[model samples]
Target: MPPAVEARPRDVRGYPVPAITPWEGGEPRFALTDHGRSADCARQRRCSVCDVPMPPGPVWRVVGATESAAIAAALASGEPYRNLAPTTEGPGHRACMLYASMVCPYLARPNARRGSSAERPDELTAHVVRGAVRGELGAVVGFGDFEYAVTETQVLFRFLDLVEYLPHDTADTHLAELRAELGRVR
Candidate 1:
């Protein structure tokens, strides 16, 4: 009989590691990453309740295209998103979704002057981009502070919050499937 090959682990940058995930039965278990650990440490230092060591890992969730698009749009629009603040300095709970049912009309509103060119939409675009990044990060890791850029076609989905911590090959495969599914909806 041939021996089964084990899958290797990869870092955030896609470099290979021995194996960050622990194996018990046949499945692998992931702990927190370095960034998560640092955040936990910072939290524990300030909060009286967070005295224990933090687990460095991510929690995964599968979302629909509509939800994903809405989130992407929000990030690109630059609205202020909500996140948790540490009570003292300990790790806080995970972030929850911050949704706005309708798109803000500020960007598409008509200019007052009939003859003049439409009002510049840059301000609204910037606001939406900022807000989306803040909000998405808040929903993922409980608290996040990252800046993002927006584009005309679709929002750039580059926030750490949007990152899935699966193995590199697995993550790539999943992304491919997601892209295909998204293409079908369009």
Candidate 2:
């Protein structure tokens, strides 16, 4: 007689859950809650940022295809989130906030700074924004579209794309001047 095969448990979605096996180091460590893990799975079931759900079952796409390559390039170069800082009494603030909201759902109101002499950290600082996300994620830094969590040791870059808006008159323009300063820390 042939040996019997074991069955797996299914979740609410009717997907089989593989049997939990002990790791070489011992019990597995999970960083996210059950609900959060479910949400992450759901997000992966669809487009990275879109709401539409993908069809059930296995599907494949070329990782470095045109669209994927574009996204990868954008994320790698930080072009998508650059130059979003606001200027005084202008559309820059609104535009930045709007763009940020698309990536970060909990983005707070814009906080402006005048000079480096300020003691408190600038609220509009991207690092501060990243900190808020880290706090909510229980210190885990997961990076995905519409969500972000990264480790302290990980190199994170907040690109402010102001190249187009920057003035061409001077070699040491305001935007160039600010970027030079920010680049040092990263």
Candidate 3:
């Protein structure tokens, strides 16, 4: 298989690049995510990046303010919650998610917006845009246990005990470290 993913791959910028992330013309498409693999990761309890079993503890999801708010509102409602739902991007190992949040261009930038429907007219892209919080506020790392909730249309992750939310920062320190590494390599 893909080397068992004991250790995940990293891009030049030192970001944890997901195994299922798309590549086009030999260049990685960092903006796009693979929905099939996302579902698989959630089902198998595997790390989205490395495709390995997650270590014991909470699973980590990179979420924006919109998702955070939806989750909070659903929890506050008190009745059985299902509509709040999950993102197509599945939970991953904490380190993997943290590294990605710190260095991935889209996640690191607080104001980066997705391309419009006119630009990317695909169902998956549409889902991504709909699920994404417009980049007005920064992202957060959410940790919890999740179970699949089957709906009439699709299956989604229903998080349990999702008590932790950490701020996702832009990669100033990581970019500086990358630059230093490049200087040494040269």
Task: Score every model by TM-score.
Answer: 0.20, 0.17, 0.61
> Judged by lDDT relative to the true structure, which candidate is superior, 2 or 3?
3
**Tens digits of per-residue lDDT for model 1, 109-182:** 12111122212324323332222222221111222322223333222212234432211211223344334533
Best by TM-score: 3
Give one clash count per candidate, in the order shown.
23, 6, 0
| Candidate 2 local Cα displacement, residue 78, angstroms | 13
Residue 68's lDDT in candidate 3: 50
Instruction: Please report the candidate that would top lDDT against the real structure.
Output: 3
Model 3, which residues run further than 4 Å from truth? 1-16, 69-83, 115-134, 149-155, 168-186
Between candidates 1 and 2, name the one with more favorable TM-score. 1
Cα error, candidate 2, residue 124 (Å) = 18
**Alpha-carbon deviation at 26 in model 1, angstroms:** 6.9
Worst 10 residues of 3 by lDDT: 116-125
Q: How accurate locally, in lDDT, is each candidate?
A: 0.26, 0.25, 0.56
Compared with the true structure, the alpha-carbon lDDT of candidate 1 equals 0.26
